[model samples]
Target: MRHVIALDVGGTAMKAALTGLDGTPLYEERRGTGRERGPEAVVESVLRFAEDLSVLGRERLGTAAEAVGLAVPGIVDAGRGVAVHAVNLGWREVPLRELLGRRLGGVPVALGHDVRAGGLAEGRLGAGRGTGRFLYVSLGTGIAGAIGIDGAVEAGSHGRAGEIGHVVVRPGGPACGCGGRGCLETLASADAVGRAWSAASGDPDADAADCAGAVESGDPVALRVWQEAVDALADGLVAAVTVLDPRVVILGGGLAEAGDTLLAPLRAAVAERLTFQRLPALVPAALGDAAGCLGAGLLARDLLAALAVRT
Candidate 1:
């Protein structure tokens, strides 16, 4: 049976899976990124984990994997197989493709931005499957989005297209990690909601979980903060919908865990903003974090097969 090795490297952990040709995931594992230790250490850790996975696949699946697909958080130059930059991972201009290819013994390898892979998964097999255009927004510790058109994730010319978090909504509202002020992410991300609620409610150290709990218990401050987040998200979505006219806008990441609390108000706010424009269906992402890995596996499978034919 043909198999592929898939990995999604996040700021916190690197999750890997061995998937069959039919998309059945046979195994999964993860390890801390240890970014504080530097990029070289992280790369070595990833290589060791992949090597172990390759060995296990041969033993358990009775065959070696054909290729490996790896996704990371950053600006991935997919065509060139390089990681231009990943601020969260502290990597810059990493030759990720060549390194992985050598580690995996020349098997075809694919490197992609983490969220782009997730967007691809949504476009191909999940909520946005039938939609020709999709805007996938993820509100996590940080916020970002991806644009998928014609069943493919559009990775812009410079590989920095879907960086919707940097969209300036409030002008000088709040400072962002990207050294900017008043970004949509500073207002609508889960972390932002939590911090906003915490400050307004006199709980200086409250986390996102606390904010969610407070919202459920009908705390006035939490409700206000959550509402504000919804409003900001709605505004951002309005602009995105106007631009792309996507059939569906898929939400993923930590904030999405709020489910109805996040989607219900968001949907209402989005509805109120639309005029004659086609109202896009707002939905939660089905695959979650696994979306990237699954999409990576699919990409690896296709790429390796094509490369084999070319050779």
Candidate 2:
């Protein structure tokens, strides 16, 4: 089978992989995205990454690549290959397909939202495998979710679905980057935990990983901060679970790195809240950060299939 290139584009780094049609990675590459310089800089980074992969694929796979699949952070109109907005990267309304397709000699390009693509990976080869209904949540710099049902990722009417982070939780709590106060993300995200811990401890430079380390050392401040974060996250998960009724809830990204430190408390919180409701099994994402690239590759693979039908 021919190969496809999978690239997950973020504000800070890019993860690229060569994957089989069956969604298996044949080879992988990782590099900094360096988007701080602006939109053109990001496009340039992607071009370089793709060029590297094209060379690697030619040498290793011994086959011409089928297409390119790129997943980007922020609001993506994947159907149109556009990056609508990425405030963190100072990018707006980027025509990713046109740029990448041109760079790769007009190879078909599939642009996708990072979270949905990651969820797609879960559906195809990770925790959501074999389950028709699934929700994959990534807890990192911020929180986002993707819903999959019947083996297809759900993109809402305007290419946004499973955006559970903005839901109001405290109503008057901390402010959020999205111009809301007491939003779910303000309370539940890894950044939120770090900020909350820092505020409570009077340490302006503290981060979530520091708090986690503090927990490991039996620090009351970190323990309390972690519990609050877990509770808020469980609240959001309950809402998602109640709405989707997924067979599995897959958590991935930076926060999930805490492993049992996060999973054990999270499981207990969800179980406690679901006393009178159906509970979904909670699982960690198997693909780690590669999930977005893997899913993006599958998007290209699906496009190839669609083209075949038309032909």
Show where candidate 1 strays beyond 4 Å. 308-311
- Model 2: per-residue Cα lDDT over 39-141, one tens digit each: 7887898888998898788888887688888888888998788899887787789888998898889888888899999999889888899989989998888
Q: State each model's C-alpha RMSD to the native.
A: 1.6, 1.8
lDDT of 1: 0.86
Alpha-carbon shift of residue 308 in model 1 (angstroms): 5.0
Q: Score candidate 2 by lDDT.
A: 0.87
The CA lDDT at 3 in model 1 is 92
Angstrom error at residue 50, model 1:
1.4
TM-score for model 2? 0.93
